[model samples]
Target: MNKNKALFTLTLVFALLFVWTVAEAGSSKRRGTAGAMELLIPIGSRNLAMGGSDIAGVSGVEAGYWNPAGLSQINNRVEALFSYQRWIGDINTVYAGVVAQLGRIGSLGFNLSSLDFGEINVTTTDAPDGTGETYTPQYLTLGVTYSKEMTDRINFGATIKLISESIMRQSASGLAFDAGVQYSMMDEKLRLGIAVRNVGTNMRFDGPDLEIKVQPPGTEPGAAQRPFRVPLQEFELPAQVELGLAHDVVASESIVWTVSGSFLHNNFSFDEYKLGTEFVLNEMFAVRGGYVLAQDPDEDTFYSLSEDFIFGPSFGFGLNYPLNATTHLKLDYAYRMTKFFDSHQLFTLSLGF
Candidate 1:
């Protein structure tokens, strides 16, 4: 009887989340208005390999970025992950995280992600021809997460993240919060997850780059210059909500198969749908595939492919090796197809102890 009640409650929560997502959908206003947009980029190769559809099924350290609620399922005492991404436009990213169990209390996680934009020539109004100087833009994020199993079938988690963006002498910093819930039903074969991310302060650029020495309008050429600073505009963070569902098709001693789907609601951009599937053999080897769909597009444009930009199909593979009774290593790789430029590739390694 209790099991039935629990299932009923879970269904009700899912329904409410779905309705809330739909109510906020189809608003194209304020597109590209958000700053620190990099936060919207998905992390964790294992989750990305599954087409960024692991919001309901992620486990351990990867949960810090995908769905913190999944961190409650950390079976191991300690889990760590290191990932490298070859992003678009020759940019590179390094992501790392660790989650440690806190006995009966909960799980604590620390994550760090950094992006290197490489060196580029700095140009100014007077140096449009050539600046002869170069500068590198850097993006970094740090997060602390916590998760606990509220009940046998329910989990809750939250994250506090700090974002930093720097270029030459100018930089901006802000904080954001993420909260998520996960519900498991039907003997843990069905999973549902809801997460709201990047809810916090707005960001704007500042620093020495904004300062300039200017002469008064009536002053002569040799007159002393006064210091003036450019006023920067504040922009909202990339806030979004996600609803994901996953079901185990085959749960056996030696083989397991799963299928998952997710809906993303963006406050400043178009909505997206993700579908993914994974097959595992003896929990050692796996293969996965996924596709992304854009909800709206400019049909009048000649190049409209459903109004999609870079999101297309994605595929990946994984391997898991157990070194000892209490230790294991895992590797994951993913390929994301794009409409322009080169495709993105991610490689990740994880250790469990």
Candidate 2:
């Protein structure tokens, strides 16, 4: 699992705490909003050991966001997952996803994720500090997807999503989409995949704001018929493209080794390359690790604390329980260490029918 993004997500918070901790520094406190949607960190095997990625062969509701094409391999039943992430301190995130077969058509899935910002008191410079108002900043994501298998080695899928970010009295909302394709060979042991996600328009804020004073009673021309607009210019959405491949070596009926690699395209910035590998013992125990390197343009990041340093490495283990030949239960755990911050932990529960 990788929490590299945590550094980026909490970047502003560190500044917030600095304002409260460092006295003189607090005098010139920085008040601002962070740009960019944090990346979706990953922590699971069956893919991680290969190279920290799998674009062409995802097979669960979580894959709906990772790679929809994996949906082609659904077993005509229902599968679901719940994951908890301990990102640094005071920041906890939860994710839930489900996939179900749709008759002879294909497979459909849903996903939801929530991010909690804890609680903070709201204040303004003029109120001389506290207006006694407080609020929490929370973010949410919801998506639905459909996938179809066209051939033994080919699959296609797509998803639509709703995103919301809310703070004390203010909020922003938007929509996005993801699409994927996957192919497999070597008796379903070798695979490849590709996906494009978060490709959509920007979001705009809609809430009470600092109002302006104006004269009434038709004193102005269109003031009575039209409203003044702040038009918080819609900004660019976080868009990404990913390609990955994986291969599994069946050491025996009970043992297997898998390796995977992924090429990522970060639209708003430089690209990234990630690789991972895992070993499974007796289909019950697994161990995995991965490394990620960012392609920096400024190259100054050769030593920067920006989330751009996803360059750190990650590792973890997992346990799987077979309910039957076509179904089972799995628990996966992962950890990631950044070059300049607290490590992250990821735990996921999966149930397959």
Candidate 3:
């Protein structure tokens, strides 16, 4: 009877998500207008290599970013992960997360991610070429997550994130929320996940940089100028909804193979369909590959024929080593293909105890 109830709840949630996706299908028209775009950047080498298709099956500390519900599936009392990515345009991304399992209470996770834009020569209208000054931009996000297993086959989780961005004397900050659910069946070999992310208040920049001295209209040029502040418009976060499915094709003592797929509907960009597969051998080594296909809103088709999208295929591998009787260490690397710039490279280290 409990299993039946779980199934009913899952169906209801899926239906609601489908309606939301359809209702927001035209959101692509508003692409590139959202703020805090860093919230949409993918983190975690393992999932990025899988084209982020493992939302249904992702677990451990990394799941705090992908689908928080999966945090409840952590196998150890404590898990920690650190990841670094060489992003496009000479930007560097760093992420760190830790999760702790609390007996029957489930799991708690905290994560921080930041982007380094390096130093740029400060250029102004008068110094278009050289300002003899340099400044670094800061973009950071901090998240707190909680996940619990509602039943043997059902898991639920939520996260709250604080985002901060600053450049020169201007800065903006806001809060975002994320929630997800995962349901498993077929003896836990098949899984389904649904998540809503980046829902929050709008953000706008405010700082001394926006203040300027300007002469009032029709006033003498020598008249005392009035201080005027440039008004900045607030922008919404890039909200999105994701639905994912995964199934274990081969499950055994020595080998396991899983195939996964997901659909991501964006409120500020084109939709995406992701497909990926993973093969593990001896429970120690694994290889993964995946592809992403963007849906063109105008054509209503899945293809990136135009230059609007750059990311394509991705591949990666993982190595797991037992540190002791109850501890383990993992290393993962991923390479993603791109168009305009160098491909992205990511490395991650994880520990479980």
TM-scores of all candidate predictions against the true structure: 0.90, 0.78, 0.96
For candidate 3, list the clashing residue pairs, or say none. Answer: none
Cα lDDT over the full model 1: 0.83
lDDT of 1 by residue, 14-121 (tens): 567557645644354666778898887678776787778869888888888878888878767999999998887888889999999998899999999999898898
Misplaced by over 4 Å in model 2 are: 1-51, 127-129, 214-230, 298-311, 323-327
**C-alpha-based local distance difference test score of model 2:** 0.68
> All candidates: CA RMSD in angstroms?
3.2, 11.5, 1.6
Over 39-111, each residue of candidate 2 has an lDDT whose tens digit, in order, gives 3545233444334575655577667767877865755398888888776655778888888888669888888
Please give the ranking of all candidate structures by lDDT, highest first, separated by commas: 3, 1, 2
Error of 3 at 57 (Å): 0.3
Q: After superposition, how far is residue 32 of candidate 3 from its true place, in Å?
A: 0.8
Clashing pairs in 1: none
lDDT of each: 0.83, 0.68, 0.89
After superposition of all CA atoms, the RMSD between model 2 and the true structure is 11.5
